[model samples]
Target chain A: MRAVAVGQAELKLFWRNRTALFNSLLMPLLLVPVLIAVDASGVPLVIGLVGFALLMAVYYNLVTTFVARREELVLKRLRVGELTDPEILVGAALPSVVIALGQMVLYCLVVAVVTGVDLPSRPWFLLLGVLGGVAIFVLLAAASSAFTRTVEMAQVTSLPILMACLFGSGMMFPLTNLPEVLAKVLQYLPLTPVLQLLNAAWADGPVIKPLTVVAVWIVLGTYAVQKWFRWDPRR
Target chain B: MTAIEVRGLTRRYSGGFEAVRGVSFEVERGEMFALLGTNGAGKTSTVEVVEGLSRPAEGTVRVLGHDPFAERAQVRPRMGVMLQEGGFPPDLTAFEAARMWAGTLTSPRPVDEALEMVDLTHRATVRVKQLSGGERRRLDLALALLGKPEVLFLDEPTTGLDPESRRNTWELIRALLREGVTVLLTTHYLEEAQALADRLAIMHRGRIVAQGTVSEVVDAYPSRISFVPPAGVTLPFVVDAEPSGRVTLRTNSLQSSLHELLAWAHLNNVELSGLDARSASLEEAFLAIAEEAA
Candidate 1:
């Protein structure tokens, strides 16, 4: 209940900053046009764009958010209240999670309309993948923030993961386009299974293997967050 | 009931720096206890331990009969803390931030009332980054008071406040004190300590050099009486007799010193001009302690 209140506040603040809102809310939407320009059909491109939005929502947005709040002592102040460490972290991530999910829905609708493609054959797979991606990336963002010493340093520390997911996770390009050996290896990166799950939902492909891969990443991400998440800023 | 107790509290950082060394004190319910110290005097460290923000290396700390660190849930809800620096979200409006903070506590006072308590109702919609330093301090106070906490910890609560705002904060704290709220405040302003603290402790070099009522600490230092005697009149009770017809007297008792000087003037039909007798003030005692520590 308290986490919901905190999340609401975070969401309000998230929108109030026009620059942040532009980056988090509108940046991915801007990418949709670029993807369409590159791929005239744009169906697979739209799916990749949605995955890219999820990456920003949980990884880029949340890493900087946690780092900025910690540097400002906001996280330390919240810890003094009834909220536990995990409560504060999860609550802080809630705003970005919601925004990312909303963006994904909007993207799917736009893709369906633009490409004249039908809706997903299985909606449950897509829903599970989206939520599971949010969960895993939220934890990874927090775990990444522990090593981020300052708000300025967040930009530097968050870049490697951003590049890795964009290039390796089928965000900017489809995994099928890669060499057989490269695709096999990239398939195990943190965000690969989520994107694969989304593709499976759209194309009526197998779900269990991708689902298992996402579950494993979720466990590893949760463990990383629990082990290294710093409630206070690095001193 | 004792609201806070620290016994043999010692806090050492990783680099062999002992911020607090065997410091102990208690704050009673309905009382205001100030902790005064110079920079690096361990005042904030001691307060942090009491607030359960940090643990003591070797000692016991209890707030309302519960170990603050071991039983944080029981003690934290009942206490309010104003950190040395305001930690509010910069993008949040003052009103929005206060409302959100209030929601984190149990049965918090109305957000509007808390803002009004700190005289911040007028700046309700202003973002925290736009607020002046004094306004930000008030915002910190507003959040601290939102919970209507039983014990309040204010670390230099009025550092950046102007004179009027400082007095207003003091009034707010006094009103809470009247309602039996225990306050443990650290301040560089000696006058603030003198005005608000029922009892205080002066810490130096991680140790408390003095702890008592304001008057008791002040009285530990000698008072001074200086006067220019009438021509050809012998000085009485003179601690120092200057050759320029000026006499300086030192005594622990100010009242008797004044009385004897007046009697001496009357007996000789001579006037004692420029008579100035003053007991030590808290500021004086504070400086004396600091000087001794140096």
Candidate 2:
């Protein structure tokens, strides 16, 4: 119940900032027209767009959010109340998660209408992929904030994961197109299984491997958050 | 009953700097205890531990009979903390921030009442970034009071307020004390401590140099009597003469010393120009401790 209040406040703040609103809600849509203009296939395009939305709306956005709140001492002040550390984090990440989920639905509808692609044949996989992706990315963003000293530094510190997800996680291009050895290694990247699960929802593909991968990443992400996530700014 | 207790509480930074060293004090219910100190004397560090913001490196602290750090869930709802800096999101209006804070408490007062307590109701719509420094401090107090906490921890709560606002805050705090709220305050302004704290501890270099009622602490230091020495007239007692021809005397018994000087002057028919006799103030005791530590 308290987490919901914190989320409501965070959502209000999210709306007041025009830049964040644009980045979370509008930036992902900008890629939609481009993919459509290029006449990309339905399944791959939807998968790539989902990956991009999760990356921007959850990961990068939360990195800045955590860093800024820490530096501003908002996290410290909130801790003085009844809110636990986990409650504070989950609450802060609520708005971004909601936005990402909303974006995924909007993207699916747009792709389905324009490209004449069928909606998800297995909607459960899509739901799992979206929910799992949000959780992992939120954890990853918080862990990244440990090294991020300032909101401005988030741009620099968040680059490596952003690049890995873009090029190595099969978000931009399918890992199957690369050598088998490279594809096998790239499948372990955080975003790969998420894209795979999204693909599994729309087309007939192996679900167990991607599901296990998603579960493993969630575990790893949770561990990383436990080990390194900092609630207070460095003195 | 004791509302807060600390024994040999020590806090160390990551770099091994001991900010608070074996500090101990007790605050009774319905009483105010001020922690007064020089800059970097660990007043804030000590208060943070009691607020359950951090754990002590050594010793133990209890708030209302529970270890604050370990039993935070039980104690937090009953205590309010106004940090040195509010650190509220700059984008939030004063009212929005109060309402948001109120949401976290189990039972909170009306947001408008909290704001009005700090005289911040008029500024409720202004963004925090646009508020003045004093206004921000008041907002911090408002949020702290939202839960109607039993124990209040104020770390320099009025640091940036104007004189009028500071007085208003004091009145508000006094009202809380009347209603049986326990207050633990830290402040650089000694007069604030003198005015508000029923008892206080003066800390220097991470240690409490003096702990007592305001007069008790002030009494430890000597009172002063100063005036220009009458030309070519010997004084009744020894005096330290300044270069400007003014002589001064420090004494524990201010009344006796002043009476003696007046008697000697009357007998000699010599005028003691610029005569002034005053007891030591908290500022004097505070500065003396700082100087002794140095």
Candidate 3:
């Protein structure tokens, strides 16, 4: 209940910042046109857009949000209240999660209209992939914020993951296009399983292997956040 | 009943720097206790421990009979804290910030009432980043009061306020005290402590060097009498003289010392120039502690 309150305030603040809003909401849409121009179609194109939305709106935005709140001492002040550490974090992340999910929905609709593709055969897998991706990315963002000393440093600290997910997670290009050995290696990257789950939503593919991978990343991400997330600003 | 208790509380940072060392004090229910200290005196560190923001490195702190750090949920709802710095989100308006904070409390006062208490109703629509420093401080106070907490912890609550706002804040605090709220305040303002604290502990270099009522702390230091001595006239009592030919006498007995000096001037038919005598004040005592620690 308290988390909802925190989330409401965060949503207001999120909307108030024009630059952040533009970056999170509009910037990722630009990639949709580029993907279309590159002749990417069907499940891969929709999955790519979903991955971009999560990365830009949820992961990147959350990293900066956490770092800025810590430096501003917002997290410290909130701790003085009844909210626990997890409650505070979840509440703060609520706006970005909602935004990313909204973007995912919009992207799916746009792709469906543009490509004249039918609805997914297994919508459950799509839902699971999207929800699981949100949880994993939220935790990863919090954990990444541990290394980010300032809001400016967020750009630097978030780069490695952003690059890894972009190039290796089958977001920009499909794994099938790469060599067999390299494709197998890249499949284990954090976002790859989420993409695999997403692809399975539209067509038949292996589920248990990708499901196990997603579960493993979620566990590791949760552990990392618990172990390293900082509430106070580093002096 | 004791509202707060600390025993041998020590706090150390990651690099082994002890910010607060072996400090202990208690405040009874419906009483105000101030922690006075110089910069780097560990007052904030000690208060943070009691507020359950951090665990003590060496001792225990219990607020309202519960370990504040270990059992925060039991204690936090009953206490309010105004940190030394306002950590409000800059993008939030004063009203929005207060409303949001109120949402987190189990039974918060109305947002309008909190804003009115801090005289921030006029600035409710202004973003925090746009507010003046004093306004920001008042907003911090407003949020702290939203929870209607039983025990309030204020760390330098009036640091950046204008004189009028400072006085108004004092009145608000006094009103809270009158209503039986327990307050634990940490401040660099000696006069504020003297005015508000029922009892205070003076800390220097991470330890309490003195703890007593205001008069008691002031009484520890001697009163002063200073004047320019008439040339070649040996004074009746020993004194410390500066190069400017001014002599100062420190004495616990202010009346007797002044009388003795007046008598000597009359007997010698000598006139004393620039004569000044005053009893010790909290400021004097505070400066003395800082010097002694130095």
lDDT, candidate 2, A80-114, per-residue tens: 99998899999899998898888878887777787
Q: Looking at candidate 2, what TM-score does chain B attain?
A: 0.97
* Candidate 3: true contacts recovered, fraction: 0.77
Give the number of the best model, judged by DockQ. 3
As a whole number from 0 to 100, the lDDT of residue B126 in candidate 1 is 97
Interface RMSD of each: 1.3, 1.0, 0.9
| Residue pairs in clash, model 1 | none
What are the per-residue Cα lDDT tens digits for candidate 2 across B1-294? 999999999999988999999999999999999999988999999999999989999999999999999999999999999988648889988899888899889999999999999999889999989999999999999999999999999999888899999999999999999999999999999999999999999998899989999999999999998999767988777777898889889999999878988898888898988988999999999899889888
Worst 10 residues of 1 chain A by lDDT: A37-46
TM-score of chain B of each: 0.92, 0.97, 0.96
- What TM value does the first chain of each candidate achieve? 0.93, 0.95, 0.97
Question: Fraction of native contacts in model 1?
Answer: 0.52
**By lDDT, highest first, what's the ranking?**
3, 2, 1
* Candidate 3 residue runs with Cα over 4 Å from true position: B266-270
Query: Which scores higher on TM-score, 2 or 3?
Result: 2
Model 1 segments more than 4 A misplaced:
A33-43, A116-122, A174-185, A202-235, B227-249, B258-273
Expressed as tens digits, the lDDT of each residue in A93-171 for candidate 1 is 8899888888877877777787787667887877888888888889889889999987668789988888888788877
Work out the TM-score per prediction. Answer: 0.89, 0.97, 0.96
How big is the positional error of residue A212 in model 3, measured in Å on the Cα after superposition?
A: 1.9
Q: Which regions of candidate 2 deviate over 4 angstroms?
A: A33-39
